[model samples]
Target: MASGSIKKEANGTWMFVVDIKDETGKRKQKRRRGFKSRKEAQAELTKLLNDVNDGTYIEPVKTTLGEYMLTWLDSKHDNMSRLTIDSYRSYIKNHVAPSIGHVALSKLSPLDIQKLVTDLRSKKDHKGRSLSASTIQRIFNIVVTSLNNAKKMQLIKENVAKLIDKPKIKKKKIEVWDVDEIRVFLDGMYDNRHYICFHLALLTGMRQGEILGLSWKNIDYEKKLIHVTQTLSHDRKEINHGAKSHAGVRSISINEKDVAELKRHAHRIEEEKEKAGEELYEDRGLVVCTNIGRPVFADTIGKMFRKYYRKFNVTPIRFHDLRHTHASLLLKQGVHPKIVSERLGHSSVTITLDTYSHLLPNMQEEAASGLGNLIFSDPQKNEL
Candidate 1:
């Protein structure tokens, strides 16, 4: 887009004109929009200049956030999964559209966004359930993102959503089981039939869905590596190959004992497969599966985890916390941040450090040791 001017007529009408390139990469192009006042026309001129400079300018449009989001979703639906499309749709219907759907795209502001989040938390659903902090944050991100695109497209002057104060979420303390506690948990798990699920959880730190959703094809017993290709969702749906973050896509090293146990389980499965008559197994070759060899439901895995907790006589924790335990353990052991980041499938080492900085012992040790030397050394004593 190129710059132009706001022309004022003798009749006291304001006219704004923007010169821009057309569909072809040629110089032949033009645009015309109007306002009731010279101030409005001047503001539009400034917006066009800034947009062209920022490389995010799109022509102004008379669309609402609700209307534009629906259009964007409709256009981009094919690029997303069934679950993701459904989720975005729900976000629009429930959060974005309901609150600020009537607000003009150009007029939405940061304060407005902050108020929306506050109201979401205080508002009660039909079931009397208040929105959680995390859920509100997710919705805020979506709404902001939609407005951000609107700004880039030149539909809005700016993304005031970016300027809004995002809600704060306190990170929960991760509970990691000590060796003795782990032993008790394992022993209690053996009494329950879902011991295999518990074994994979603590031993590998793989997610519940990853374990329940594991297929034989993703397992490389020869290499002793577990390839995480898909995750089992909390809703019992299997989403193929998408992880919570890029860092979540990882292959983990298993212990020899785990390898031996898996071998036994494999043989048992083989026997069952042979006895069940030839090809009942889809040959998809899942490492863990249900009776007919399809992926197990995520709820079933959670139930199994809870059962083992009761049997173990220990503090009950959510299954996802196991992954946190694994990362926390590695951090405590002074493992490099880069390695942990890769193992966890975090996008970068920065994320790993930010998330687990409290658990990291090496930096604390260095800082402590350095401070002691600086404070108590002979040179410092003499100087003081």
Candidate 2:
């Protein structure tokens, strides 16, 4: 029986080979080269035998980490969104491929992964800026997922990243405005051009894209509802893409006051259209658009809000925070979390709860007190 052998190759490297039966009962030889010495070759052979006995031996493939990562990204291109694919491409190019791309996929170890993360954390640019712990963790997670996919494809026998510890990330505190502050801001901009935009965002808790993507057809004047079917892409594309998820496609009831304002805005748009004529009116039919009816850019809206922000002299909060403020105010008033989740187009009530759980303790106490008052108002009921 042919067991194993170690010999010097013509290129001054030691090569080891082991004769074994594969899963199909066919005789095969597992050969590995590139060992610098006979001792290393013998030690590898011994370990190979142990692995074969333990039923964990896998034939290693000669593929570098960079090659596998590129292949992996190509494989996932169709499954991921445009923005997501772009982000993954950037992460791989900037962080992963530059570091451990030379290592063999099967030979990559937990130590190598740990060292890569440490290096990433310690590195600083000329401006003395290092990667944030969260960013480092995100890069590490991408590698972990890529390796996990490789394992699933049987490209590697094990995922080394799974054995490595993830970097710790500090969660930033969520800032929101109270109703009084919101009132001050809205009142300050009562006659401003983008007043309706701020009104819908604070009232409905819709995302910036959703608000910007709204069309006249999406609104139901009779039922007082706004259908959220799609949102604007980050690049300010006009055509609406489907909302983030199925849960994101929802209909939120609009208050009559906001509905009347929307009607007035629509009439104003129509007047502007008649004056400008069909030539000047681009006619994308967006609820919020430019003077000639082209889709409004998100940055433009943000800049407008910032200008009014200084005028209002209220607490400084990003326009996105208006959505959070809406959710927070509703949760404090004891609105059902499911309702809040639906209005905000969150994927689940759990997300809503987790995001606003800071306010839950007070709500819980109020709920308990109300229940006690309802059930224990009578002395006999209290005793029972």
All predictions: root-mean-square deviation over Cα? 6.0, 3.8
- lDDT per residue for candidate 2 within 74-144, as digits (tens), equals 88867766777778888777777778878899889998898789779887756999988887998889898
TM-score of each predicted structure versus truth: 0.77, 0.85
Candidate 1 residues 126-168, lDDT tens each?
7999877788888888787777777666677678878867877
Best by TM-score: 2
Q: After superposition, how far is residue 153 of candidate 2 from its true place, in Å?
A: 1.4
Deviation in angstroms for 249 in model 2? 1.7
State the lDDT at 6 in candidate 2. Answer: 92
Runs with alpha carbons beyond 4 Å of true place in candidate 1: 1-60, 191-193, 275-283, 360-384
Per-candidate total of colliding backbone pairs: 11, 0
